[model samples]
Target: MKVYLAAVATGLLLIAESANAISVNVQAGRHFTHTSAAIGDNSAGLSFNGNWARSDHNGQLGSLGTAFSLPVGPLTASIGGKALYLSPKDGKNGEALAAGVGLSWTVMPSLALYGEVYGAPPRLTSGIDSYAEAAGGLRFTVFKPLTVDAGYRVMNMRGKEGNRDNKLADGFYIGAGLNF
Candidate 1:
């Protein structure tokens, strides 16, 4: 928790000096794993994507920071850290500051294919120390400001005192979002 706060504090400090734009995205999904039946794995969250106030040695904004935006040929590649607060059905809650990286390919004007990988270390989590996830999905621009998406994700978490990790969730989800 301290690490997450420190990271956010550092990011906010960096943002104070730059002229950047923020893009918001919200998502919700269902899970299939029963390893932790006490916590039904449904999840939802929102994120802010933006360029930081400073540029790296490579002249890329947030290139070496907690957030980054870089274009690789026809694909847009981005990486950032996200703090997540998850509420389970059984109430055995979990929180983690996870770092994620993703790539998107616009195969068509209104359609794109994307994939992302996210992981949270023990230092960033409470109770459970290690968490990891991977997802792939299709995104369709439904209107000028709205997009509809569907995807599948797999995630697992391990306790600090335990030798084995628990499979948390694996399922498909449908969602909609507005991008500005």
Candidate 2:
């Protein structure tokens, strides 16, 4: 599992390094009691976003694959697909892919509200049955090249254990991220 995770992370890093426009994101969150954590579970991840096009009506721009954003009146609608690596502490760790779509509304020049959902089916990741996640939050621009975001995320994963349905991770989480 460690080898698998290292390989996946290396692949993602290589892809991001060669991408046209790239950004690095770091996020941290806490899981609820319903999750696998006995006392409290804390989750964190680093992601590299790359190959972004210009943002226009029906255009492709932002993080993930083929990301695009459009200004619908005063709101922005965006969607993208992402392939990710999973290294859960309580389950079989592997790789998975997710297709995500989101909507964002800018309340002010530096503040925006957004919500997104991502889903992956069985067999998408090795040794995993299925996974799904959803998040909603607010983002605030603190400086020109820096942004801060806080959100609530819910994630569920089922592991492949022969005929047994192993619930790996499931519950709500509160997280924060830095985008640059």
Candidate 3:
């Protein structure tokens, strides 16, 4: 846990020092928390994220990713890939390279809706058969550089031996973000 936190902090610091635009986000649910930091403009950027959960079943997950976004009118489309690491308390640890697509639409000047999905096939994964995640939410900009959001996320992993299929996290979360 400490190592994860340190890694995220170091990544964020490096991004802050070199990027003109940066965003940091934090989300929390009943049994899990997610955090991410990114550097880049709306058109493209690199991001680092970490998730931690504590429950009857829990784990830690992290990813480093990059995205290219295209804006058309009031909507944006993005394509990205992430290098993921998962360590579950009761399952095998694994690593995957996943591809993802995302879309976001501006509902109003201060509100927007967004969703994304990521998946990895057996060929791109190790110590696991596959990995998948889906998430969506509404974001409300409270001010120029601050925003709040509510969202739901679900993540799954299939074990190599077909014995440790796990729902890493499946729940709703509320989060806040800072942009600069």
Candidate 4:
């Protein structure tokens, strides 16, 4: 856990140097905590992101990815791929490469909605049969650079062997974000 935290912290520091825009988010739930950072702008820039999550059921999961964003009217759409490393408390560790899409819409100056889905088939995974994740949330901007959000997320992984399937995270989470 300490190692993962350090890696994310280092990534954040690196991102702060050259990114035109940057954001960091932290989330917590009953038995789960997640942290992520991204650097880029919505109009058209290469976005780099990294995330770490720890859960009672899954132990830990971490990912790194890059995305390209395109703006259409009041919405922004992104396409990306992520490389995921998963360590389960009672199962074998695994790696997966997932392809994903995300969409965000600004409803008002202060409110927005966002959703994303990522998945990896058995062929794109190792030590695990498959991986999938979906999340959506409503975000409220408290001010220009601060926001709060609430959301539901579900992440699942199926191990190669039976009895190793794990629901890494499921249910609601509340989070806050800083954008600069």
Best by TM-score: 4
Which pairs of residues clash in candidate 2, taking residues 3 or more apart in a chain or in different chains? none
Candidate 3 regions exceeding 4 Å error are: 1-19, 43-56
Query: Against the unseen true structure, what C-alpha lDDT does each candidate score?
Result: 0.56, 0.53, 0.80, 0.87
Error of 3 at 121 (Å): 0.7
After superposing candidate 1 on the true structure, give the runs of residues whose Cα lies further than 4 Å from its correct spot.
1-66, 86-95, 160-168
Per-candidate total of colliding backbone pairs: 2, 0, 0, 0
- How accurate locally is residue 132 in candidate 3, as Cα lDDT from 0 to 100? 91
Candidate 3 collision pairs: none
* Tens-digit lDDT string for candidate 4 (1-180): 999999999999887776678899998887888899987774465788999988876678899999999888889898999999988776788899999999999899899999999999999988788989899999999997999999999888877777477777898999999988
RMSD of each: 14.1, 14.2, 8.1, 8.1
Error of model 2, residue 40, in angstroms:
36
In order of appearance, the predictions have TM-scores of: 0.58, 0.58, 0.82, 0.86
Point out the worst 10-residue segment of candidate 2 by lDDT.
35-44
lDDT score at residue 12, model 1, on the 0-100 scale:
94
Error of 3 at 32 (Å): 1.5
Q: What is the lDDT of residue 177 in candidate 4?
A: 94
